[model samples]
Structures are given as structure tokens and as C-alpha cells.
Target: MTTTTEPTARPRTHKRVPAAPNRARKNPTRKRGPGSYAVIAAVTVFVLAFLSPFAIILVNSFKTGADYRANGSLSLPEQWNWSVIGDVWERVEFTQKLINSIQISLGVVLIAVVLALFNAYAIGIGRVRWRTAFLVFFLGVNVLPQEGLVYPIYYLFKEMGLYDGKLGYTILVGITYSAFGTYLLSSVFSSFPKELIEAASLDGAGRWTILWRIVLPMSWPTLSVMCVFFFVWSWNEFLYPLVLLISNDNQTVPLGLSVLQGQYSSDPTSMSAAALLGVIPMIVFFLIFQRSLTRGLTAGAVK
Candidate 1:
């Protein structure tokens, strides 16, 4: 009994333990919520709404004129007249017009790209004196009503002996109207890391070399976007060509298509066919460059 009492005399001391790790504290903002599904649904609806117009156009393109007029644009053709497409091809000189459009569009793309590259470099990398002033001047021209320029441009071209069936029309249009492209490309150029240019210079690269090899390669996405836009604009341009070129053969596809429309006035089928022919190439071009366009937009946005 004495031994047991002696052993019990020493009291046991308790040791404290550290608290459990706070799992929720790791990333508190990542907690799931109810509104996410609503956002997803809204985006889905918006995309579908955007797609509906193109869907209608494509559907209508396939329809026969009678079927279209009778059943409406929403309905499919009772018979897909593949021959009508051929008929249109023969009458509209589709190949020639398409080639002409391609040539004009490509010319515009090349000229726009060249001018935009230089202007963007000057504004973005060089930061030349009065850069902002120059940029503002271009912006003013871009935003100003085309009606204001029409009379002046016409008068100037006439004065310079650059009017009517001259390649000058294409060149002048490409060069003078390039300010908008410059503004757009300048934004992308501004976003590029200046360190790349500095490093290139440090390695004994000339400005031209760096621009061609380093900057151009890295700037493909934005450049591709601008190219597509310029090409589309040039290809679709009607008024400018109409005003600039007086000769029938000098006319671009857009103007030529109007002529073709008159020639095929009695044939709605032929008109529809010609319309399809005119549009298909553009659709093809879009499909080809769509990835680049999307990539460019996303890159520009994120940067």
C-alpha cells in the first residue's frame, strides 16, 4: 500500500498537439458556386444566336428558286440543282473574276502588310518624334467620312493623271488607305516585348534584319489577321474600283458581278448561282485563315 501511494505521487504532465492544416485556406477563391452554369448557358445561347444567320444563308444557297420562294428561306430545296451552279459558272466568267479578285486582294495584302509593318515599327519600337501626332492624323483620316475624301481623292487622282484603268488606282488605294492597318498592327507591335529587339541589337543584328527575322516571325498571328481583313476588304470593294476604273475590263469582280447580274436578270436561278460562285471563294479563304484569325484575336486580347 505504501509503494502504490509513492508511485501515484508524481502527476502526469499533458503535451499539446499542433492544429490540423486548413485545407480551405489553400485557395479560398476557388470555391464552387451556383452562377457558373448560368454563365455557361448564356454563352451557349449567344453562340447559337450568332450562328443562325450563317446557317440560314447556307441553307438558302442550297435551295431551288421555286422552293425558296414557295417554302421560304428556312426550308431546304425540293431538288438541289447542281446544274444551275454550272450554268452560273459559265455565264459569270467565274474563273476570270475569281482570279482578278485574288490578284487584287493579294496586292492589297502585300501593300498593307509592308506599310503597316514600317508604320508600326516607327510608332511602337522606334517611338519616333511626333509619333502620337502622326498616329492621331492617321486615326482622323480613318474615322473621317469617306464622302469627304471621295471628291478630294477623285480630284487629286485626276490632277496627277492617275485616274482610269491605271494600276495607280490599286497602288494609291492600297497605300493611302493603309493607315487603318497601321493603327491596328501598331497595337499588336506595342504589346511585343522590347527586350527581344534590344537583345537582337546587342547580338549585332541590324534593324532590317531584326524586323524581318525576329519581329515578323513572332508577329505572324496579328499579321495573318490583318492580311485576311485587308484581302476581304479589297475583294469586296465596289465603290472605289467603280470610281477609279472607267473601262469595262478594268472593273474588279464586285463591279463586274453587278454587270453579270444584269445579264442574268431573267434567270433567278443563274443569279443565285452567280451569287454562290462569288461567295464560295471568300468562304474558302475564311475557312483557311479562321484559325489564324482566332489565334490573332486571342493573342492580342491576352497580351
Candidate 2:
């Protein structure tokens, strides 16, 4: 029958093909190039630049009076003057001034945050008719230079019998500065979702509850940042405390540090020691909250 149908199609022969190996299994390590070296070099340079001043200060802090005077600002200390720190501690009363600064900074941060949060809530989430006007007024305060306002503020404090004491003077200064903080936080609050408030309200939560529970939790990043800013500002505030607060007994750290410099001008070693002591707390604070500061500063900028 026609040669048995072409030998039954040669039994339909099939070829076996091997499975492809996984691409991920081959050379999982990434290759480094000139770009990686460039990045490393750039990072090293930046780190050195940032640390140079600190190194200078640290080395100077440990130097003897003669060494500090003879050697340059960049020179290393020949002998460790460990006693310089104790000499500064007693002469400057660093601990007392530190306590005073800490109290004032903490108070200012607390008051500023509270006022700012509430003001921001009102302007941003609330349906108040004067929201825009209030926002503008607050913004105006920020534009006015603190230097220009110093004279007027000092005179006002002098007239109002609020210039000398610890609590009243510090509180008033913080209140005056609170306006700018309020404006900043208000901008953050404005960016919050309205649905959050509405949802809270619908769930039988009051305004205060919504603010404390919902708004404050979400606003932590902003609050943390503002706290750090206010703390640093109030801590380093020299001119205001110098001009307004007349009592050295109640002097803040900045003023006290200046007084320490005056009292120890002849002792260069002690001066550096005092300066290092003054800077330590601030350095600690910044180190702790620096990440939050960076995050909060850029968090809501996009929208």
C-alpha cells in the first residue's frame, strides 16, 4: 500500500531541550566602577570638612595656656590639660547656667508647640472666617527682623515690669517668638487630610480629642522639628537675654558663656574649656533629633 505510508512518519521523532539556568544564579555580585570610587571620595571629603572645626575645638580644649597661646588654632595640644575643665566648671558655674538654659528652652518649646498646634488646627482644619487674615498677620511677624524688633521689645518689657525676673521675662520672649512657630506649624496642619477630622467627628470624637489623638500623632515629625528649632534658638539667644534680663544670677547659658569669656580672658585654656562645655549640650541635642529635623523640614514641602 504505497510503501507502508512512508515508514509511518518515522515514529514522530522529538528532540529533548535542556532547561535554562536562572539568571539570578550567575554573578549575583554587582560590579564597582569609577563612580563608586568617586562617591567614596566625595563622602570622605565632606566628612573631613564637617569634622575639621570640631577637631580644632577638641584639641584646643585639651591644651595648656601656653600651648594654646603659642600654637595656632589648628595645632594639637602638646600636653592634656585635664584640669582646665574643672577650672572652668567652678569659675563659670557651668552647671547652674546649664540648668537655667535647659528650663527656659524646655518651657519655650512646650509653649511654642502647644500654641502653634492649636493655631494651626484652627487655621488649617477649622472653618473660621478669619483664617486667612490670621495667617497673614502671623506671617508678617516672621518677615520682621528680630534685630529690628529688639529695641522695641526691650523697651516694652522695661515698661511692663517684665524685664528682670527669670520666669516672666523668658516666658514673654517665648510668647513673642511663638507667632513664627505658629505660622510654621499652621502650614503643616493645612496639609493634613480633612477626611481625618471629619472621620473623627463622625465617630463621636470632640474637636479636642481629634486634635490630641489624631492630629498630634500625625504631626509628630513637625512637632519634633519645631521643638529642636525653638530649643536651639532660645538656648543660643544672647542679645535678647543680655539686653532684657539684667540679672547675671539668672543669666541663660549664652549670656553666662559670654560672661565666662570676660572673666577668663587671660586664661585661654579655661576659655576653650568653657566654650567646649557650653557647646556639649547643644551638640547632644542636635545629635538626638537631627534625623527628625531633616524629615520634618522636607516632609510636607512637596504639597
Candidate 3:
């Protein structure tokens, strides 16, 4: 009887135990913290801020002046019209301006690219004396704003009788643009494979022969990229061309656009459309040669 009572009392003293934690299930359905959402929101805001101005420009370009003034600059237009581009073109004499732009841009590209190639070869590969000094001088020139040079150049051009003509202006721009090309092309030339150059030298190749036969042929892509950049820069150049080109006949696209601003200052739509047209060639040029540009930029950064 005593044994049976002791066994029953032991059953009454039993306690409950907790189950083990799930170590095998690694972070199932992890909830994103507030930081991730904040990052996404910030990036979206940054993108929108940058794009808003261009979006407004494109939208406003399609609307009439009346609508734009009535609805404000950011409002959606009741009507969209493509004819504004044509009207602006006719008023601005777009054809002549386009021709002038092309001529000036081509001249700049040709002169700058060719001179840059020769000068960079001398400095970068040929190891010319005082090369670092020359590079520093060009760097100083490159950083000097066109505004600072305008007065000096204006006086110089007047003295030389080159102030208001297309050829003279083109020459001036090409020379200024060559500063950038020289630096960029020097980098490209400096990055050329030393082993190949040594091999060619061992093969009895003279400097001129190496430049023309090996360097020039191999660097066509970089040359093309530099040419395109030079062309675009010369095309969009406003101040130098504006100050130098007083004659209506010699004015380029940017000058024409400025003229339209005075003539059609009240008509914002027409002005924007014409401005858009002027930049279209640049956009197209970049799109077409983007691959080459990308390649050229990367190809000479390393041996």
C-alpha cells in the first residue's frame, strides 16, 4: 500500500518543457527594414529631379504660347502640335544655319583631330623634351573659360581682320578645341602596348613609319571618337561664335536660336522646337557612334 501511494505522488510532481528553436530555417520571409524603402524613394526623387526640366521643355515645345501662358510651364497641353518646328525653321532660316553649323563643326573636327594626333605622338610616345611643361601649359589653357578669352580674342581678331568671318572663326575654335584633343589623345597614345612598340622598333621601324603604319591605323577608333566630340562641341558653341559672328549670313545654329529668342521671345513653343531640332543631330551622332566612343574610351586606358 505504501509503494502504490509513493508512485501516485510522483505522477503529480511532473513538469512541462519547451520545444527547441528552428535552426534549419534560415531567415524565412525576411521583412525589409525602413532603410531599403528610404533608399528607393531617394533614388526615385533624384532621377525625377534631373529629368523634370527636359520633360518640361519637351512638353512645352509642343504647346502654343497661349496655352503655355494660360496653363503654366508644367501643365499638360490641351493640344500638341508638330508644325511649330516647321514654323520656327522658316522664321529662323534653319537651312542656312544648319549649313554653317556643319561647316564650322567639320573644320574644327578636322584641324583639332589631326593636330592632336601629331602633337600627342611627339609628347606621349616620342618623349619630347619639356613634354610635362607643354602638357601643363595646355591644361592651363583648357581650364581658362571662354569668357576670359573673349575680350583678348576679340581685340586680336580685330587686329588681324578675322573678327566676323566663318573661316577665321572656325580656325579660332579649332585651335581652342585642340587643347582638349591633345590631352585626350596623349592619354590614348601613352597607354599603347610597350611590347608591340618595342617589337616594331626591333624590326627597324622608324618613328614616322611606326606612327603612320602602326599607330595611326590602330588608333582610328579613338580618332573617330575625338572627331565626333570636337564636332558636337563646335556645334553647340554659343559665346565665341556669337561675339565673333556679327554678320547674319555667318551665324551658326546657336546664334540663329538666340536671334529667334529676340524675334519670337513671346512664342516659347516655336523657340523650344527649333532648339530641339538643333540638338537632334548631336543626339543622332552620339547614338550612331556610341559603340565606337565606348570602345575608344576604354581601349587605351591600359596596356
Ordered from best to worst TM-score, the candidate numbers read 2, 3, 1
Please list all clashing residue pairs in model 2, or write none if there are none. none
Better of 1 and 3 by TM-score: 3
Candidate ranking under lDDT, highest first, comes to: 3, 2, 1
Please provide, for model 1 over 119-192, each residue's C-alpha lDDT reduced to its tens digit, 9 standing for 90 to 100. Answer: 99888777889988988988887888766777888988889888884466778668755888888777777777
1 or 2: which has the higher lDDT? 2
- How many angstroms is residue 286 displaced in model 1 relative to the true structure, after the best TM-score fit? 1.8
All models: lDDT?
Answer: 0.76, 0.80, 0.85
lDDT of 3 by residue, 1-303 (tens): 455444445456556676786579566887889999999999999999998877877888888878988998888889997788888888888899999999999999988888888899998898899988989987888999989999999999999999899989989988888888888778778878778789999999988899998889888878878887888889989999889998878999988887666643466787778768877888888999898888877764443
Which residue ranges in model 1 land beyond 4 Å of their true spot?
1-75, 260-268, 300-303
Name the 10 consecutive residues with the lowest summed lDDT in model 1: 260-269
Model 2 Cα shift for residue 117 (angstroms): 0.8
Q: In model 2, which runs have C-alpha deviations exceeding 4 angstroms? A: 1-21, 25-39, 262-266, 290-303
Candidate 2, residues 95-126, lDDT tens digits: the string is 78888889888988888778888777888778
Residue 101 lDDT in model 1? 70
